[model samples]
Target: MKSLTAGAEIDAWCTKCRMDLMHRIVAMVQSAPKRVICLTCNSEHNYRAPRTETTASGVHVRARNTGPKPSPAAARVTQKARAEKERADSWSSKTLGQAVDAFTRYAMDKSFREGELVLHSKFGEGYVDKVLEGAKISIMFRDGARTLAHRAN
Candidate 1:
Protein backbone atom coordinates (compact mmCIF):
# COMPACT_ATOMS: atom_id res chain seq x y z
CA MET A 1 0.00 0.00 0.00
CA LYS A 2 1.26 3.49 -0.83
CA SER A 3 1.90 5.92 2.04
CA LEU A 4 -0.75 8.62 2.67
CA THR A 5 0.17 12.30 3.04
CA ALA A 6 -1.20 15.74 2.35
CA GLY A 7 -1.38 16.48 -1.43
CA ALA A 8 -1.25 12.74 -2.16
CA GLU A 9 -3.72 11.46 -4.78
CA ILE A 10 -6.08 8.73 -3.54
CA ASP A 11 -9.40 7.09 -4.47
CA ALA A 12 -12.28 8.42 -2.31
CA TRP A 13 -16.04 8.65 -2.56
CA CYS A 14 -16.88 12.13 -3.84
CA THR A 15 -20.15 13.30 -2.29
CA LYS A 16 -20.76 15.94 -4.93
CA CYS A 17 -20.04 13.60 -7.81
CA ARG A 18 -21.57 10.61 -6.00
CA MET A 19 -18.82 8.31 -7.21
CA ASP A 20 -15.44 6.95 -6.33
CA LEU A 21 -13.08 9.38 -8.02
CA MET A 22 -9.50 10.52 -7.74
CA HIS A 23 -9.07 13.03 -4.91
CA ARG A 24 -6.14 15.03 -3.64
CA ILE A 25 -5.73 14.94 0.12
CA VAL A 26 -6.14 18.42 1.57
CA ALA A 27 -5.96 17.57 5.30
CA MET A 28 -4.69 14.67 7.37
CA VAL A 29 -5.34 13.48 10.94
CA GLN A 30 -3.25 10.81 12.64
CA SER A 31 -1.79 9.86 9.23
CA ALA A 32 -5.33 9.39 7.80
CA PRO A 33 -6.89 11.65 5.21
CA LYS A 34 -9.56 13.81 6.84
CA ARG A 35 -10.49 16.06 3.91
CA VAL A 36 -9.99 15.83 0.15
CA ILE A 37 -10.77 17.68 -3.07
CA CYS A 38 -12.19 15.87 -6.06
CA LEU A 39 -9.99 16.12 -9.15
CA THR A 40 -12.99 15.49 -11.45
CA CYS A 41 -15.40 18.19 -10.17
CA ASN A 42 -13.11 20.35 -8.02
CA SER A 43 -15.42 20.01 -4.99
CA GLU A 44 -14.03 19.78 -1.46
CA HIS A 45 -15.60 17.50 1.17
CA ASN A 46 -14.83 15.09 3.99
CA TYR A 47 -13.11 11.89 2.96
CA ARG A 48 -15.24 8.75 2.68
CA ALA A 49 -13.71 5.33 2.11
CA PRO A 50 -14.71 3.59 -1.09
CA ARG A 51 -17.09 0.73 -0.24
CA THR A 52 -16.36 -2.70 -1.73
CA GLU A 53 -17.96 -6.12 -1.32
CA THR A 54 -16.58 -9.61 -2.06
CA THR A 55 -18.68 -11.61 -4.49
CA ALA A 56 -19.13 -15.41 -4.49
CA SER A 57 -16.38 -15.57 -7.14
CA GLY A 58 -13.93 -14.02 -4.61
CA VAL A 59 -13.69 -10.80 -6.58
CA HIS A 60 -14.12 -7.41 -4.93
CA VAL A 61 -16.83 -5.24 -6.48
CA ARG A 62 -17.79 -1.67 -5.59
CA ALA A 63 -21.12 -1.61 -3.76
CA ARG A 64 -23.47 1.29 -3.14
CA ASN A 65 -26.09 1.06 -0.41
CA THR A 66 -29.63 1.42 -1.80
CA GLY A 67 -31.51 0.81 1.44
CA PRO A 68 -34.27 3.06 2.71
CA LYS A 69 -33.02 5.91 4.90
CA PRO A 70 -34.56 8.27 7.43
CA SER A 71 -36.90 10.87 5.98
CA PRO A 72 -35.41 14.39 5.68
CA ALA A 73 -38.91 15.89 5.83
CA ALA A 74 -39.49 14.31 9.25
CA ALA A 75 -36.17 15.64 10.51
CA ARG A 76 -37.03 19.12 9.23
CA VAL A 77 -40.43 18.97 10.96
CA THR A 78 -38.79 18.05 14.27
CA GLN A 79 -36.27 20.92 13.98
CA LYS A 80 -39.01 23.40 13.04
CA ALA A 81 -41.10 22.34 16.05
CA ARG A 82 -38.18 22.92 18.42
CA ALA A 83 -37.41 26.30 16.87
CA GLU A 84 -41.10 27.33 17.06
CA LYS A 85 -41.18 26.48 20.76
CA GLU A 86 -38.08 28.59 21.38
CA ARG A 87 -39.52 31.51 19.42
CA ALA A 88 -42.81 31.26 21.33
CA ASP A 89 -40.94 31.34 24.64
CA SER A 90 -38.95 34.39 23.56
CA TRP A 91 -42.10 36.15 22.30
CA SER A 92 -43.92 35.44 25.55
CA SER A 93 -41.10 36.83 27.64
CA LYS A 94 -40.92 39.99 25.52
CA THR A 95 -44.70 40.52 25.40
CA LEU A 96 -45.31 40.03 29.10
CA GLY A 97 -47.54 42.77 30.62
CA GLN A 98 -48.01 44.32 27.17
CA ALA A 99 -51.55 45.14 26.08
CA VAL A 100 -52.85 43.90 22.72
CA ASP A 101 -54.11 47.38 21.79
CA ALA A 102 -50.61 48.84 22.15
CA PHE A 103 -49.40 47.31 18.89
CA THR A 104 -49.71 49.40 15.74
CA ARG A 105 -51.47 47.75 12.80
CA TYR A 106 -49.06 46.71 10.04
CA ALA A 107 -49.22 48.49 6.71
CA MET A 108 -46.78 48.38 3.83
CA ASP A 109 -47.22 52.06 3.18
CA LYS A 110 -46.75 53.02 6.82
CA SER A 111 -43.34 53.67 8.37
CA PHE A 112 -42.13 51.82 11.48
CA ARG A 113 -39.15 52.16 13.80
CA GLU A 114 -37.09 49.56 15.58
CA GLY A 115 -38.25 48.46 19.12
CA GLU A 116 -41.86 49.29 18.19
CA LEU A 117 -44.64 46.67 18.29
CA VAL A 118 -46.84 46.01 15.30
CA LEU A 119 -49.77 43.71 14.48
CA HIS A 120 -49.74 41.82 11.20
CA SER A 121 -52.73 40.20 9.60
CA LYS A 122 -50.82 37.04 8.70
CA PHE A 123 -48.05 36.83 11.33
CA GLY A 124 -50.00 38.18 14.33
CA GLU A 125 -48.24 40.55 16.75
CA GLY A 126 -44.53 41.23 16.25
CA TYR A 127 -41.80 43.51 17.55
CA VAL A 128 -39.83 45.54 15.04
CA ASP A 129 -36.33 44.07 15.38
CA LYS A 130 -34.58 46.16 12.78
CA VAL A 131 -35.12 48.74 10.07
CA LEU A 132 -33.43 47.25 7.03
CA GLU A 133 -32.30 48.89 3.80
CA GLY A 134 -34.69 49.48 0.91
CA ALA A 135 -37.84 49.93 3.04
CA LYS A 136 -37.52 46.47 4.57
CA ILE A 137 -37.92 45.71 8.30
CA SER A 138 -37.26 42.59 10.35
CA ILE A 139 -40.01 41.73 12.82
CA MET A 140 -39.82 39.13 15.57
CA PHE A 141 -43.05 37.19 15.88
CA ARG A 142 -44.07 34.18 17.94
CA ASP A 143 -43.25 31.91 15.05
CA GLY A 144 -39.98 33.55 13.96
CA ALA A 145 -38.35 36.70 12.68
CA ARG A 146 -39.52 37.82 9.22
CA THR A 147 -38.56 40.58 6.81
CA LEU A 148 -41.34 42.71 5.45
CA ALA A 149 -41.51 45.78 3.26
CA HIS A 150 -42.51 49.10 4.88
CA ARG A 151 -42.46 52.79 4.10
CA ALA A 152 -38.95 54.14 4.69
CA ASN A 153 -39.84 57.76 4.05
Candidate 2:
Protein backbone atom coordinates (compact mmCIF):
# COMPACT_ATOMS: atom_id res chain seq x y z
CA MET A 1 0.00 0.00 0.00
CA LYS A 2 1.36 3.42 -0.92
CA SER A 3 1.51 6.20 1.68
CA LEU A 4 -1.49 8.61 1.40
CA THR A 5 -1.31 12.35 2.09
CA ALA A 6 -2.96 15.60 1.05
CA GLY A 7 -2.15 16.53 -2.58
CA ALA A 8 -1.39 12.88 -3.39
CA GLU A 9 -3.03 11.36 -6.47
CA ILE A 10 -5.21 8.26 -5.96
CA ASP A 11 -7.84 6.25 -7.75
CA ALA A 12 -11.23 7.28 -6.35
CA TRP A 13 -14.81 6.82 -7.37
CA CYS A 14 -15.95 10.12 -8.89
CA THR A 15 -19.54 10.71 -7.85
CA LYS A 16 -20.17 13.38 -10.49
CA CYS A 17 -18.63 11.43 -13.33
CA ARG A 18 -19.86 8.08 -12.00
CA MET A 19 -16.54 6.42 -12.76
CA ASP A 20 -13.26 5.35 -11.27
CA LEU A 21 -10.84 8.15 -12.06
CA MET A 22 -7.59 9.63 -10.79
CA HIS A 23 -8.19 12.21 -8.05
CA ARG A 24 -6.06 14.66 -6.13
CA ILE A 25 -6.68 14.47 -2.39
CA VAL A 26 -7.84 17.84 -1.07
CA ALA A 27 -8.60 16.99 2.57
CA MET A 28 -7.57 14.31 5.05
CA VAL A 29 -9.06 12.73 8.20
CA GLN A 30 -6.69 10.88 10.53
CA SER A 31 -4.33 10.19 7.57
CA ALA A 32 -7.23 9.02 5.37
CA PRO A 33 -8.40 11.03 2.35
CA LYS A 34 -11.71 12.76 3.15
CA ARG A 35 -12.21 14.86 0.03
CA VAL A 36 -10.79 14.73 -3.48
CA ILE A 37 -10.95 16.50 -6.81
CA CYS A 38 -11.27 14.53 -10.04
CA LEU A 39 -8.34 15.28 -12.36
CA THR A 40 -10.37 14.18 -15.39
CA CYS A 41 -13.71 15.97 -14.70
CA ASN A 42 -12.45 18.81 -12.45
CA SER A 43 -15.25 18.08 -9.95
CA GLU A 44 -14.61 18.07 -6.21
CA HIS A 45 -16.41 15.64 -3.89
CA ASN A 46 -16.03 13.42 -0.87
CA TYR A 47 -13.57 10.61 -1.41
CA ARG A 48 -15.17 7.25 -2.24
CA ALA A 49 -13.34 4.01 -2.82
CA PRO A 50 -13.98 2.11 -6.03
CA ARG A 51 -16.43 -0.75 -5.36
CA THR A 52 -15.41 -4.20 -6.49
CA GLU A 53 -17.05 -7.62 -6.15
CA THR A 54 -15.64 -11.14 -6.37
CA THR A 55 -17.58 -13.20 -8.86
CA ALA A 56 -18.15 -16.95 -8.81
CA SER A 57 -15.28 -17.31 -11.27
CA GLY A 58 -12.99 -15.68 -8.64
CA VAL A 59 -12.54 -12.68 -10.88
CA HIS A 60 -12.83 -9.17 -9.41
CA VAL A 61 -15.56 -7.06 -11.06
CA ARG A 62 -16.58 -3.47 -10.46
CA ALA A 63 -19.82 -3.29 -8.45
CA ARG A 64 -22.63 -0.99 -9.53
CA ASN A 65 -25.86 0.20 -7.91
CA THR A 66 -28.89 -0.72 -10.00
CA GLY A 67 -31.30 1.40 -7.97
CA PRO A 68 -32.49 4.83 -9.01
CA LYS A 69 -30.94 7.77 -7.20
CA PRO A 70 -32.02 11.38 -6.86
CA SER A 71 -29.92 13.83 -8.86
CA PRO A 72 -28.22 16.85 -7.28
CA ALA A 73 -30.12 19.27 -9.52
CA ALA A 74 -33.50 17.79 -8.50
CA ALA A 75 -32.59 18.07 -4.82
CA ARG A 76 -31.54 21.69 -5.31
CA VAL A 77 -34.83 22.55 -7.02
CA THR A 78 -36.82 20.98 -4.19
CA GLN A 79 -34.77 22.84 -1.60
CA LYS A 80 -35.27 26.13 -3.45
CA ALA A 81 -39.03 25.60 -3.61
CA ARG A 82 -39.17 24.87 0.12
CA ALA A 83 -37.10 27.95 0.95
CA GLU A 84 -39.29 30.19 -1.24
CA LYS A 85 -42.41 28.87 0.48
CA GLU A 86 -40.93 29.55 3.93
CA ARG A 87 -39.94 33.08 2.90
CA ALA A 88 -43.40 33.78 1.53
CA ASP A 89 -44.97 32.49 4.72
CA SER A 90 -42.69 34.64 6.84
CA TRP A 91 -43.36 37.74 4.72
CA SER A 92 -47.12 37.17 4.92
CA SER A 93 -47.06 36.74 8.69
CA LYS A 94 -45.05 39.91 9.17
CA THR A 95 -46.88 42.18 6.71
CA LEU A 96 -50.45 40.92 7.08
CA GLY A 97 -53.12 43.68 7.14
CA GLN A 98 -50.46 46.44 6.91
CA ALA A 99 -51.47 49.46 4.86
CA VAL A 100 -49.29 50.25 1.82
CA ASP A 101 -48.92 53.89 2.87
CA ALA A 102 -47.49 52.83 6.24
CA PHE A 103 -44.20 51.89 4.59
CA THR A 104 -41.57 54.64 4.79
CA ARG A 105 -39.46 55.10 1.68
CA TYR A 106 -35.94 53.80 2.30
CA ALA A 107 -32.98 56.20 2.17
CA MET A 108 -29.46 55.80 3.46
CA ASP A 109 -29.62 59.17 5.21
CA LYS A 110 -32.85 58.24 7.06
CA SER A 111 -32.83 56.58 10.48
CA PHE A 112 -34.94 53.49 11.16
CA ARG A 113 -36.25 51.56 14.15
CA GLU A 114 -37.10 47.92 14.66
CA GLY A 115 -40.54 46.78 13.32
CA GLU A 116 -40.70 49.80 11.01
CA LEU A 117 -41.92 49.18 7.46
CA VAL A 118 -39.66 50.26 4.61
CA LEU A 119 -40.17 50.62 0.87
CA HIS A 120 -36.92 50.08 -1.01
CA SER A 121 -36.56 50.95 -4.69
CA LYS A 122 -34.66 47.77 -5.52
CA PHE A 123 -35.62 45.23 -2.84
CA GLY A 124 -39.27 46.26 -2.70
CA GLU A 125 -41.23 46.39 0.59
CA GLY A 126 -39.56 45.16 3.79
CA TYR A 127 -39.80 45.58 7.55
CA VAL A 128 -36.96 46.40 9.87
CA ASP A 129 -36.40 43.18 11.85
CA LYS A 130 -33.52 44.47 13.91
CA VAL A 131 -31.65 47.71 14.49
CA LEU A 132 -27.94 46.88 14.66
CA GLU A 133 -24.88 48.77 15.82
CA GLY A 134 -22.90 51.04 13.46
CA ALA A 135 -25.89 52.34 11.51
CA LYS A 136 -26.89 48.90 10.21
CA ILE A 137 -30.29 47.21 10.15
CA SER A 138 -31.61 43.78 9.23
CA ILE A 139 -34.73 44.06 7.10
CA MET A 140 -37.01 41.22 6.09
CA PHE A 141 -38.31 41.61 2.53
CA ARG A 142 -40.62 39.46 0.41
CA ASP A 143 -37.71 37.39 -0.88
CA GLY A 144 -35.53 37.26 2.25
CA ALA A 145 -33.75 39.23 4.94
CA ARG A 146 -30.98 41.64 3.96
CA THR A 147 -28.59 43.82 5.92
CA LEU A 148 -28.50 47.44 4.80
CA ALA A 149 -26.78 50.57 5.95
CA HIS A 150 -28.96 53.21 7.58
CA ARG A 151 -28.30 56.74 8.86
CA ALA A 152 -24.95 56.71 7.02
CA ASN A 153 -22.60 59.44 8.09
Candidate 3:
Protein backbone atom coordinates (compact mmCIF):
# COMPACT_ATOMS: atom_id res chain seq x y z
CA MET A 1 0.00 0.00 0.00
CA LYS A 2 1.20 3.48 -0.86
CA SER A 3 1.51 6.25 1.77
CA LEU A 4 -1.42 8.67 1.92
CA THR A 5 -1.03 12.47 2.14
CA ALA A 6 -3.23 15.53 2.01
CA GLY A 7 -5.49 15.62 -1.06
CA ALA A 8 -5.19 11.88 -1.49
CA GLU A 9 -8.42 10.23 -2.65
CA ILE A 10 -10.14 7.88 -0.22
CA ASP A 11 -13.57 6.49 0.59
CA ALA A 12 -15.38 7.92 3.61
CA TRP A 13 -18.90 8.14 5.02
CA CYS A 14 -20.23 11.68 4.94
CA THR A 15 -22.45 12.30 7.92
CA LYS A 16 -24.18 15.21 6.22
CA CYS A 17 -24.53 13.52 2.85
CA ARG A 18 -25.29 10.20 4.57
CA MET A 19 -23.49 8.07 2.01
CA ASP A 20 -20.23 6.39 1.26
CA LEU A 21 -18.49 8.70 -1.22
CA MET A 22 -15.07 9.60 -2.46
CA HIS A 23 -13.24 12.02 -0.15
CA ARG A 24 -10.08 14.01 -0.28
CA ILE A 25 -7.73 13.56 2.62
CA VAL A 26 -7.48 16.87 4.50
CA ALA A 27 -5.17 16.06 7.41
CA MET A 28 -3.16 12.98 8.24
CA VAL A 29 -2.39 11.68 11.71
CA GLN A 30 0.48 9.21 12.03
CA SER A 31 0.23 8.28 8.31
CA ALA A 32 -3.56 7.77 8.65
CA PRO A 33 -6.29 10.03 7.43
CA LYS A 34 -7.69 12.08 10.33
CA ARG A 35 -9.88 14.53 8.40
CA VAL A 36 -11.36 14.43 4.92
CA ILE A 37 -13.85 16.16 2.63
CA CYS A 38 -16.47 14.53 0.47
CA LEU A 39 -15.77 15.49 -3.13
CA THR A 40 -19.34 14.69 -4.19
CA CYS A 41 -21.04 16.65 -1.37
CA ASN A 42 -18.40 19.21 -0.40
CA SER A 43 -18.86 18.38 3.27
CA GLU A 44 -15.85 18.29 5.58
CA HIS A 45 -15.55 16.22 8.70
CA ASN A 46 -13.45 13.67 10.52
CA TYR A 47 -12.55 10.71 8.36
CA ARG A 48 -14.95 7.81 8.99
CA ALA A 49 -14.50 4.56 7.10
CA PRO A 50 -17.77 3.17 5.86
CA ARG A 51 -18.96 -0.05 7.51
CA THR A 52 -19.92 -2.70 5.03
CA GLU A 53 -21.87 -5.89 5.68
CA THR A 54 -23.44 -8.77 3.77
CA THR A 55 -27.13 -9.59 3.89
CA ALA A 56 -28.87 -12.98 3.56
CA SER A 57 -28.72 -12.65 -0.24
CA GLY A 58 -24.98 -11.98 -0.01
CA VAL A 59 -25.30 -8.41 -1.22
CA HIS A 60 -22.85 -5.76 0.03
CA VAL A 61 -24.49 -2.74 1.67
CA ARG A 62 -23.45 0.24 3.72
CA ALA A 63 -24.69 0.49 7.31
CA ARG A 64 -27.60 2.70 8.35
CA ASN A 65 -28.16 5.37 11.08
CA THR A 66 -24.95 7.27 10.27
CA GLY A 67 -26.52 10.55 9.27
CA PRO A 68 -25.84 14.00 10.70
CA LYS A 69 -26.82 14.81 14.25
CA PRO A 70 -29.63 17.18 15.05
CA SER A 71 -28.85 20.87 14.85
CA PRO A 72 -28.65 23.11 17.97
CA ALA A 73 -31.16 25.59 16.58
CA ALA A 74 -33.98 23.11 17.06
CA ALA A 75 -33.14 22.63 20.73
CA ARG A 76 -32.75 26.37 21.22
CA VAL A 77 -36.13 27.03 19.67
CA THR A 78 -37.77 24.37 21.84
CA GLN A 79 -36.27 25.89 24.98
CA LYS A 80 -37.22 29.38 23.90
CA ALA A 81 -40.76 28.27 23.12
CA ARG A 82 -41.12 26.67 26.55
CA ALA A 83 -39.85 29.82 28.21
CA GLU A 84 -42.19 31.95 26.13
CA LYS A 85 -45.09 29.76 27.18
CA GLU A 86 -44.18 30.36 30.81
CA ARG A 87 -43.80 34.08 30.25
CA ALA A 88 -47.11 34.15 28.40
CA ASP A 89 -48.88 32.79 31.48
CA SER A 90 -47.63 35.72 33.53
CA TRP A 91 -48.48 38.19 30.74
CA SER A 92 -51.92 36.72 30.07
CA SER A 93 -53.66 39.48 31.93
CA LYS A 94 -52.75 42.13 29.37
CA THR A 95 -53.52 42.56 25.70
CA LEU A 96 -50.88 43.57 23.17
CA GLY A 97 -51.72 47.25 23.28
CA GLN A 98 -52.23 47.06 26.99
CA ALA A 99 -48.86 45.48 27.39
CA VAL A 100 -47.29 48.18 25.28
CA ASP A 101 -48.99 50.84 27.39
CA ALA A 102 -47.70 49.20 30.54
CA PHE A 103 -44.09 49.94 29.53
CA THR A 104 -42.64 53.33 28.79
CA ARG A 105 -40.56 54.29 25.84
CA TYR A 106 -36.83 53.80 26.33
CA ALA A 107 -34.83 56.98 26.46
CA MET A 108 -31.11 57.38 26.90
CA ASP A 109 -31.73 60.17 29.38
CA LYS A 110 -34.28 58.17 31.35
CA SER A 111 -34.12 55.55 34.09
CA PHE A 112 -35.73 52.13 33.86
CA ARG A 113 -36.68 49.31 36.22
CA GLU A 114 -36.17 45.64 35.76
CA GLY A 115 -39.05 43.64 34.21
CA GLU A 116 -40.44 46.77 32.65
CA LEU A 117 -41.11 47.01 28.94
CA VAL A 118 -39.46 49.59 26.76
CA LEU A 119 -39.89 50.75 23.18
CA HIS A 120 -36.72 51.59 21.36
CA SER A 121 -36.57 53.76 18.28
CA LYS A 122 -34.31 51.29 16.50
CA PHE A 123 -34.71 48.00 18.35
CA GLY A 124 -38.52 48.23 18.29
CA GLU A 125 -40.02 46.87 21.55
CA GLY A 126 -38.49 44.72 24.27
CA TYR A 127 -38.81 43.80 27.93
CA VAL A 128 -36.20 44.74 30.46
CA ASP A 129 -34.76 41.46 31.67
CA LYS A 130 -32.17 42.71 34.15
CA VAL A 131 -30.70 45.91 35.55
CA LEU A 132 -27.03 46.32 36.32
CA GLU A 133 -25.34 48.94 38.48
CA GLY A 134 -23.45 50.43 35.54
CA ALA A 135 -26.47 52.07 33.90
CA LYS A 136 -27.10 49.03 31.75
CA ILE A 137 -30.14 46.85 31.24
CA SER A 138 -30.51 43.51 29.56
CA ILE A 139 -33.51 43.59 27.27
CA MET A 140 -35.22 40.60 25.72
CA PHE A 141 -36.32 41.45 22.21
CA ARG A 142 -38.23 39.38 19.73
CA ASP A 143 -35.13 39.11 17.62
CA GLY A 144 -33.01 38.03 20.57
CA ALA A 145 -31.54 39.44 23.81
CA ARG A 146 -29.54 42.61 24.01
CA THR A 147 -28.03 45.04 26.54
CA LEU A 148 -28.39 48.77 26.39
CA ALA A 149 -27.47 51.83 28.44
CA HIS A 150 -30.03 53.36 30.76
CA ARG A 151 -30.39 56.00 33.50
CA ALA A 152 -28.34 58.50 31.56
CA ASN A 153 -30.42 61.24 33.13
Candidate 4:
Protein backbone atom coordinates (compact mmCIF):
# COMPACT_ATOMS: atom_id res chain seq x y z
CA MET A 1 0.00 0.00 0.00
CA LYS A 2 1.28 3.50 -0.90
CA SER A 3 0.52 6.78 0.90
CA LEU A 4 -1.06 9.49 -1.36
CA THR A 5 0.25 13.00 -0.89
CA ALA A 6 -1.16 16.27 -2.17
CA GLY A 7 0.22 17.83 -5.42
CA ALA A 8 1.54 14.45 -6.59
CA GLU A 9 1.18 13.36 -10.25
CA ILE A 10 0.35 9.79 -11.20
CA ASP A 11 -0.36 7.70 -14.27
CA ALA A 12 -4.08 6.96 -14.66
CA TRP A 13 -6.37 5.50 -17.35
CA CYS A 14 -8.68 7.95 -19.13
CA THR A 15 -11.96 6.38 -20.25
CA LYS A 16 -12.42 9.24 -22.76
CA CYS A 17 -9.01 8.63 -24.40
CA ARG A 18 -9.10 4.85 -23.76
CA MET A 19 -5.46 5.04 -22.62
CA ASP A 20 -3.30 5.30 -19.52
CA LEU A 21 -2.11 8.91 -19.19
CA MET A 22 -0.53 11.27 -16.71
CA HIS A 23 -2.80 13.13 -14.26
CA ARG A 24 -2.15 15.72 -11.57
CA ILE A 25 -3.16 14.95 -8.00
CA VAL A 26 -6.16 17.03 -6.94
CA ALA A 27 -7.63 15.25 -3.91
CA MET A 28 -7.24 12.04 -1.86
CA VAL A 29 -9.06 9.91 0.72
CA GLN A 30 -7.66 7.57 3.38
CA SER A 31 -6.89 4.05 2.06
CA ALA A 32 -8.33 4.90 -1.37
CA PRO A 33 -6.99 5.38 -4.95
CA LYS A 34 -5.52 8.92 -5.12
CA ARG A 35 -8.48 10.35 -7.18
CA VAL A 36 -6.44 10.62 -10.36
CA ILE A 37 -7.48 12.95 -13.23
CA CYS A 38 -6.42 12.59 -16.87
CA LEU A 39 -4.44 15.54 -18.28
CA THR A 40 -5.52 14.89 -21.87
CA CYS A 41 -9.24 14.38 -21.19
CA ASN A 42 -9.28 16.62 -18.10
CA SER A 43 -11.64 14.15 -16.43
CA GLU A 44 -11.58 13.29 -12.74
CA HIS A 45 -12.39 9.78 -11.52
CA ASN A 46 -11.45 7.55 -8.66
CA TYR A 47 -8.20 5.65 -9.19
CA ARG A 48 -6.27 3.19 -7.08
CA ALA A 49 -2.96 5.04 -7.52
CA PRO A 50 -1.57 8.25 -6.00
CA ARG A 51 -0.61 10.99 -8.48
CA THR A 52 2.44 13.26 -8.84
CA GLU A 53 2.69 17.03 -9.58
CA THR A 54 3.11 17.55 -13.33
CA THR A 55 2.34 20.40 -15.77
CA ALA A 56 -0.72 20.03 -18.02
CA SER A 57 1.61 20.38 -21.09
CA GLY A 58 3.60 17.22 -20.26
CA VAL A 59 0.77 14.85 -21.36
CA HIS A 60 0.14 13.61 -24.93
CA VAL A 61 -2.55 15.84 -26.49
CA ARG A 62 -5.40 14.23 -28.42
CA ALA A 63 -7.46 15.93 -31.13
CA ARG A 64 -10.74 17.16 -29.75
CA ASN A 65 -13.90 16.54 -31.80
CA THR A 66 -15.10 19.86 -33.23
CA GLY A 67 -18.78 18.99 -33.57
CA PRO A 68 -21.48 21.61 -34.22
CA LYS A 69 -23.38 22.78 -31.20
CA PRO A 70 -27.17 22.52 -31.26
CA SER A 71 -29.33 25.66 -31.52
CA PRO A 72 -31.97 26.41 -28.85
CA ALA A 73 -35.39 27.04 -30.41
CA ALA A 74 -36.93 27.73 -27.00
CA ALA A 75 -34.48 30.56 -26.41
CA ARG A 76 -35.56 32.22 -29.69
CA VAL A 77 -39.23 32.13 -28.66
CA THR A 78 -38.41 33.74 -25.30
CA GLN A 79 -36.43 36.53 -26.98
CA LYS A 80 -39.32 37.29 -29.40
CA ALA A 81 -41.86 37.45 -26.58
CA ARG A 82 -39.70 39.96 -24.69
CA ALA A 83 -39.40 42.17 -27.80
CA GLU A 84 -43.18 42.17 -28.35
CA LYS A 85 -43.80 43.29 -24.76
CA GLU A 86 -41.48 46.28 -25.25
CA ARG A 87 -43.46 47.38 -28.31
CA ALA A 88 -46.78 47.05 -26.49
CA ASP A 89 -45.55 49.24 -23.60
CA SER A 90 -45.35 52.25 -25.97
CA TRP A 91 -49.16 52.61 -25.83
CA SER A 92 -48.59 55.24 -23.11
CA SER A 93 -47.27 57.59 -25.80
CA LYS A 94 -50.86 58.35 -26.88
CA THR A 95 -52.61 61.59 -25.78
CA LEU A 96 -54.17 61.47 -22.29
CA GLY A 97 -57.62 62.26 -23.73
CA GLN A 98 -57.24 59.58 -26.39
CA ALA A 99 -55.99 57.14 -23.79
CA VAL A 100 -58.94 57.91 -21.52
CA ASP A 101 -61.37 57.50 -24.40
CA ALA A 102 -59.80 54.17 -25.30
CA PHE A 103 -59.76 52.92 -21.70
CA THR A 104 -63.39 53.98 -21.11
CA ARG A 105 -64.59 52.01 -24.13
CA TYR A 106 -62.48 49.06 -23.03
CA ALA A 107 -63.90 49.32 -19.48
CA MET A 108 -67.50 49.21 -20.74
CA ASP A 109 -67.59 45.50 -20.03
CA LYS A 110 -66.35 46.21 -16.45
CA SER A 111 -68.32 47.91 -13.66
CA PHE A 112 -67.31 50.97 -11.61
CA ARG A 113 -68.55 52.39 -8.29
CA GLU A 114 -69.70 55.97 -7.58
CA GLY A 115 -66.59 57.28 -5.74
CA GLU A 116 -63.98 55.00 -7.20
CA LEU A 117 -61.09 56.65 -9.03
CA VAL A 118 -61.38 55.90 -12.74
CA LEU A 119 -58.69 56.81 -15.25
CA HIS A 120 -60.06 58.31 -18.46
CA SER A 121 -57.18 58.37 -20.93
CA LYS A 122 -58.21 61.86 -22.08
CA PHE A 123 -59.92 63.41 -19.02
CA GLY A 124 -57.52 61.91 -16.48
CA GLU A 125 -58.94 60.61 -13.13
CA GLY A 126 -62.68 60.93 -12.36
CA TYR A 127 -65.48 59.18 -10.43
CA VAL A 128 -68.36 57.34 -12.03
CA ASP A 129 -72.00 56.68 -11.05
CA LYS A 130 -74.41 55.72 -13.88
CA VAL A 131 -74.77 55.57 -17.64
CA LEU A 132 -77.01 58.06 -19.50
CA GLU A 133 -78.77 57.95 -22.88
CA GLY A 134 -76.99 58.02 -26.32
CA ALA A 135 -73.16 58.19 -26.52
CA LYS A 136 -72.98 60.38 -23.39
CA ILE A 137 -71.00 58.98 -20.37
CA SER A 138 -71.32 60.45 -16.83
CA ILE A 139 -68.25 61.10 -14.65
CA MET A 140 -68.20 62.79 -11.19
CA PHE A 141 -65.15 64.93 -10.50
CA ARG A 142 -64.09 67.30 -7.68
CA ASP A 143 -66.00 70.05 -9.50
CA GLY A 144 -69.17 68.02 -10.15
CA ALA A 145 -70.74 65.39 -12.40
CA ARG A 146 -70.04 66.07 -16.09
CA THR A 147 -71.15 64.18 -19.17
CA LEU A 148 -68.81 63.47 -22.06
CA ALA A 149 -69.53 61.99 -25.48
CA HIS A 150 -68.04 58.49 -25.79
CA ARG A 151 -66.60 57.57 -29.15
CA ALA A 152 -65.31 54.12 -30.08
CA ASN A 153 -62.12 53.96 -32.10
- Using TM-score, give the best candidate's number: 2
In every candidate, how many clashes are there? 0, 0, 0, 15
lDDT by residue (13-109, candidate 2, tens digit) is 8899888889999999998999999999999999988643213323422334343788999999999999889878878777777798989999988
User: Which residue ranges in model 4 land beyond 4 Å of their true spot?
Assistant: 1-3, 48-153
Q: Please state the error at residue 109 of candidate 1 in Å.
A: 0.9
Global local distance difference test of model 2: 0.87
lDDT of 1 by residue, 1-153 (tens): 988999999999889988888999999998899999999999999998864411332342223434367789989999989988987887777665689888989999999999888899998888898899999999998778999999998
**Two-way lDDT contest, 1 vs 3, winner:** 1
lDDT of 3 by residue, 54-125 (tens): 132234223353447767998899998998876665443322465557768888778888778778888777
Model 3 spans with C-alpha error above 4 angstroms: 1-60, 64-95
Instruction: Choose 1 or 2, whichever is better by TM-score.
Output: 2
Q: What is the TM-score of each candidate against the true structure?
A: 0.43, 0.45, 0.43, 0.27
Q: After superposition, how far is residue 32 of candidate 1 from its true place, in Å?
A: 45
Model 1, residue 137: distance off in Å is: 0.4
Q: Give the local distance difference test score of model 3.
A: 0.76
Please give the TM-score that candidate 3 achieves against the real structure. Answer: 0.43
Model 2 earns a TM-score of 0.45
What tens digits encode model 4's per-residue C-alpha lDDT throughout 35-101? 7777888888766332232323334232243436545887798888886665334323322244444
Candidate 1: C-alpha RMSD to true structure equals 17.4
